[model samples]
Target: MGHPHRLGIVGLGNISAAYLDTLADSAQIRITAVADLDTARARTLADRLPHARALSVSELVASDEVDTVLNLTIPAAHAEIALAAIGHGKNVYGEKPLAARMADAREIVAAALAAGVGLGSAPDTVLGTGLQTARHAIDDGLIGRPLAASAVMVTAGHERWHPSPDFYYQSGGGPLLDMGPYYVAALVHLLGPVRSVTGAASRLRGTRTITQGPRAGAVIPVDVDTHITGVLEHDSGALSTITTSFDGAATDAAPLEVHGENGTLSVPDPNRFDGETRFFELGATQWRPLPTAAGYLDSARGIGLLDFIAAGPDRAARANGDIALHSLDVMTSLLQSAAEGRRLELTTTTERPLAVPLTAREVWSQRE
Candidate 1:
């Protein structure tokens, strides 16, 4: 390898720790700089890395030592940080929902293309053994022709755990926008791009109290819907029903499932890197767990970044910008469809990303 990609991280939130943990031992990337709105937070994390230094958000984006910016900012700030990094000609990989709005997301994608910079987004979890194995099975005809899918995610609310859960209830935040990206992204990976959608939504509580962290007992206003249900029509004619909610206390529904002409696949949670992918054939009496047939083994949050950088110029990253934009469009259109009480055609679409060939942790970590 010529040299490890110099990485600058722009957010030090709860999610950042997970990425940091995953990238800590990577040989193909180096944490060169760290920045956060809270200067102290950046300094504290930077101090833990021998070669890293803390910088202001502006400085980090423009740093000569940095080649790529890992953006972990909240949904609302995604475009701002991404645009800044792209403006400085840095490759960017960020947490999901590319932007809170489709207009901003399109502008970000346009800016990156104009600047000739690489862009990627999260829920890279789909590239892990769990979802990829499912994809492999689908593609291998283990499930004949995929006809439909269903994804369900239900929880009381994030305010029960996330300290600063305000963002989860804000304009750009909600059950569908926050959690739907993972499921939608996975659906796109498994079935294909969505052509249109019909949706319905409801906000169960107007206010919620924080139950954990420093903000425990603090009440926050809810500005967006807490529950969302939708049916997606994939370009390939596969239909997927989805439900994401902060209103429900819990659910026994499987995280994801795909039905085909000859079999049914039970996919693990998209938010997780690995889990059991079960399948039931047309005449089978019991579901069987599929072997790990594809994707990164023992991977985590930052694997997508590694995959993005490794793609080089030959192909788009598995978690590239186009898919993120399409996922965003699917989600925003769902909300719009709900509000309008009608099915709406999506304005954006992307070819299903290439499936991740089964890879070991040691191999991908050292890959260029």
Candidate 2:
């Protein structure tokens, strides 16, 4: 615990910069190496980082200096990179959806378990104030006996601004897969685990044109559904209806809203680290913003890793792979339910992660 845990980052994409921003002042972790298929991009990050060296993916995962591999690889390659990191006997954490498929996610989990290394995943946005405050309200009984919830994410899609938006429409990419993790993770935090799901999905367009970024005017193929809606039956007797769509332009939908026996909680967007969390009592006329009463306030991307690290070897990390797998299981089942036109029972289950107390960032880093 005397030295910062050495982090080897694989995949230096747009998101990598945000993680680097969070890691800059982190006492719990430090970037020791970075890798990307774009070698020059890796070199660029290495130049800007205080002590990071540019290495090949293989080298970075195997580097003796690295204690954990912070995998930011695209969804399709998530398992390959994670399995490789675990093979090297290093702990691993990555971006959402765990992998392109549940099978790969299962493999990733199995390998990490066998290797005895820590496994964690993202949409760590749940570890932030927005979702945590809402959770605090429910746990505090401000919202009595949670009964139902809704998670909505509707947009025209990422091709509008992303330079290369090909992945968003690919087999591993879809509104449900790309954006559902945040909502699903947040829902699990609010209402335990999911037991089953029933879904319906549709696609009205076959192709899309990139409207912005360097690849403007480029046409991308659409291989997945553009619109998806589903109902989740949580084990705790709470039902959640979720809709994730790239086909819609806008909506008045709250990012998330949880209704209980006595009150309704309008949660903030789980895609971000912080925001206003609004709530309304049974007889209240209007919703009110809840104070930041739990979780890490004023935080960002890599805090998940910090939180995971803070949990130590003997404790369970809130963002651990078990929950990510459960979330992915829920999302994939939604798609399956859509195709089969029937509700699907989930094959995985996970406990609600322990709540984050209102601890200062420095204190988390200093924990044993």
Candidate 3:
């Protein structure tokens, strides 16, 4: 292999640890620098890595030691950090939604394209066996022709668990924006890009009290809608119904379900890396568990970055910027439709990402 990609990470928040754990022993990549709003936090993390140093966010993005920026910052900071990395001629891979708004998302994509740098987004969980196996089934005609799907995510709220859950209720953070990316990305993988959307939304309550963490018993204001329902019309003519809520206590609904001409497929939660995919044929008496047949087995958060690097000069990364931009467009358009009380056509579209062939842990753990 050639030189490992030098990674400079911005944002040392909750999700950062998961990525660190996934990439700690990688041979194809190296963590060279760390940065966060809290210098002490960045220093603490960098101290643990023999080859890494703590730096300010701006310094890290401009440093000669870094070739790519792994952005784990909040949604509001996503575009800012990404643009800085792109401006310095470095590739970027960031947490979902691409950015807090479509305009920023477009600017980031355009900047990366103009700078000739690769850009990637997260919720790479779809690259795992759970979603890929189901996609494999659909592609192999096990379900004939897919006609529709349903994605449901219901939770009381995040304040009960997350100490810094203020973002969950902020403008860029809502039940739909928080949890919708996983399901929407998975739907794009299972079905195809959405062409139009119709939606309705509501806010359940004005305030919520934190039940755990340092902020336990503290009340926070709710600004965005707590419940969101929408219909996505896919380019393939498949229709999908989606419901995301922070107002509910719990639900037993299959996290996702796809129905086709000859059968129905029950997909596991898209937020997870792997789970059992069950199928019920048109005439079958019961649902049967489908064997895992595709994707990176035992993969985690960093696999998407590895995949982006491995994609080389020949093809787009499965989690490339276009898919992310389109997904965000679909989501934002849904909310816009809700506000306008009318169906809205999407302004962007993308080809369905290439499928991941069944791959083992050892095979995908390193860059191909």
- Tens-digit lDDT track for model 2 on 1-368? 22688899999898988887788657677788999999999898899878899999999999999999999989999999999999999999999989989999999999999989999999889998888888888999988999999999999999987989899999889999999999999999999999999999999699999999878998889999999999999999899999999998898989999999999998888998789988888998997888899988777898898878767766799999999999999999999999999989999999898888787766654432
Measured with C-alpha atoms, the lDDT of residue 79 in candidate 3 is: 92
Q: Please, what is the whole-model Cα lDDT of each candidate in the order they appear?
A: 0.93, 0.90, 0.92
All candidates in order of lDDT, best leading: 1, 3, 2
Per-candidate TM equals 0.98, 0.97, 0.98
Q: Tell how far residue 111 is off in model 1, in angstroms.
A: 0.1
Per-residue alpha-carbon lDDT of model 3 for 1-368, expressed as tens digits? 13687899999999999999888678878889999999999999999987899999999999999988999999988999999999999999999979999999999999999999999999899999999999999999999999999999999899978998998898889988889999999999999999999999999899989898877999999989999999999999999999999999999999999999999999989999899999999999999999999989998888888888788767789999999999999899999999999999999998899999999998878633
Error of 2 at 117 (Å): 0.5
In terms of TM-score, how similar is model 1 to the real structure? 0.98
Please state the error at residue 58 of candidate 3 in Å: 0.5
In candidate 2, position 268 carries an lDDT of: 85
Which stretch of 10 consecutive residues in model 3 shows the poorest summed lDDT? Answer: 1-10
Enumerate residue pairs that collide in model 3.
none
Error of 2 at 262 (Å): 0.5
